[model samples]
Target: MITRRMLLGTMVAAPAAACAHSLTEPEYPRVGAVERLDPRLDAIIAPDAPIEVLATGYSWAEGPTWVDRGGYLLFSDPPNNVVHRWQPGVGAAPFLKPSGLAGPIPAAVREAGANGLDIDRQGRLVMADSGTRAIARVDLATKQKTLLATRYQGKRFNSPNDLVISRTGAIYFSDPPYGFSAFDESPLRELLFNGVYRLAPDGSVALLDDSHHRPNGIGLSPDERTLYLALSDEKRPQVLAYSLDAYGMPTGAPRLFLDMSEGLAAGRPGLPDGLKVDSAGHVFATGPGGVHICTPEGDLLGIVATGKAVANCALGGPNGRDLFLTSHDMLARVRLSRPA
Candidate 1:
């Protein structure tokens, strides 16, 4: 990724009604640095690689994923109820209007759009929809949405925040009350506890854990033997790993994968928010100070410090070597030596 001031400069120089219609690789200005904490990071990322800005001016951007078939990236702007598409040469554009909320949102709702996104085995876009309080599937070509799960034991979910799909067609996700204005205290909240759940292929939803105050991001190891959860709890910010059975069910208690209390204590800008695992098992998690790159054993190797709160990230590009990040208002990317 390279930095370019000329593209943004030209857009500013243009008259209000005169916008460029040409599609070319838009080189955006770069911000942040690759902070190497261990020599092992050299094998994953280039120490001098730049974090190139792809887009900006979003209202709480989250849930980024790459569409390999489309050769582009899609991310959420929750508060604005929009899903944006970003391409190498075209930059950012709205992919879906009313990305989650189709009508007026509840007065107490803070965010009313889709949060986390992933492609299922069938190539359909699966979403953790905070507005509809469910896990949904969207047809990429028609934009038709199908709500897969909205309730558990007859009670509506607080809000489905993030999700990951297993090879067996099962879906794992986290439910928190971040969509509500008062979070857990909001009147709109139905579930008494924030939970991590699994939706099996048979349309059954099972609770994995209900103790985490707020579990935000969910991912799986390359082998799908462990589930990695990122806790957004500021009081106990950390990443947790849970062993999974062959059926993709949690088989045991969770273990601490990485503790971020020290990073928070050091006055970093973000909490453990979203995460992803590379093919080689490295965990690239968005936590205190930015994206923390760690090993399977929970050793931090480096960080992609964005100087802002990064919400989510996705591995995409021609060879899945591009690390796309949704950093608050901006969308940025870093070229990685190792593909996800």
Candidate 2:
């Protein structure tokens, strides 16, 4: 029952006499600073943007989604099997318990909870329910979950990790073996390969790609002409972009978008996990070192370094300029120049 307010109190308990600051003191505890790579980053991020830590101590926070209707943020802590809601003024609280599995915890899974979340066109919460190995939709009012897709061809998914929804109501998601305690070698794993899939509005599931060893995060470009996939493979941490056909299917092989090998070698804590595209087509992808901001052309602009393994990010706020991060054990946020 640890709430955000409790964590905040513990984090900012310093004596005023010992740490006095000017009127410009930040309201929250700031963990990291913005790493500006290109001069263009100045246009996207303020020169003094601080990575403000909002909450601490989650099992493994992931899948941040901004609920515009309620003006709140929702994110998943997979290992704890909970979804938390963070509001601007009220702070963070548990929004759903048993956020993934309703039954007894299964021995096969290491983390039996939802990993990714997004709001559908109808404003219902859609989730990558790793506990059930399926993609499901959640009704906000009654907290009811309806399974959308559970299997592909005839095999159960290893685990649905992350997802993005197209304007046409198509749900594009990634399935990897992260949920399994033994990973790909787990006896419970049904799929031979990790895959990126598309769940059509007609309830049919289509396999987009199965080449990636660990496809973790998924996103669509603002124009919706390209789809981005993040490979969490430690050896080849990178992002790939695929050209989508008019039918909303990938038309050709994916091309390299951003490589995080150098950052990984430098000992950055995170792998490429979750990402989001801004209204102006800029990409904010979580990778080694923090969240990497890049242009549509894949030029590196900057990094929102959280000093921890960042798992996911979402854009929202009263003005849609706030970038919320779900770091490994805490939640943080930074203000962006552009809207999401």
Which candidate number would show the highest TM-score if scored against the true structure? 1
Write model 2 residue lDDT over 100-206, tens digit each, in one string: 98779878787898989999877789999998899999987778899999999999999899999999999999998888877888999888999999999999999
Off by over 4 Å in 1: 1-24
The candidate that wins on lDDT is: 2
Q: Model 2, stretches more than 4 Å misplaced?
A: 1-26
Each candidate structure's TM-score, on Cα atoms with residue i matched to residue i, is 0.92, 0.92
C-alpha lDDT score of every prediction, in listed order: 0.86, 0.86
Q: Candidate 1 lDDT, tens digit per residue, 1-340? A: 1100111010112231122223456667999999999999999998899999988898778999887666677899888989988767667899888888788887998789999999886668899999889999998888999999999998999889999999998999999888887788899877899999999888999999999987989999999999999998777888999999888888889999999888877877788888999889999999878899999999999999888888889997756799999988899999998777
- Against the correct fold, how does model 2 do in TM-score? 0.92
Assess the local accuracy of residue 235 in candidate 2 as a C-alpha lDDT between 0 and 100: 71
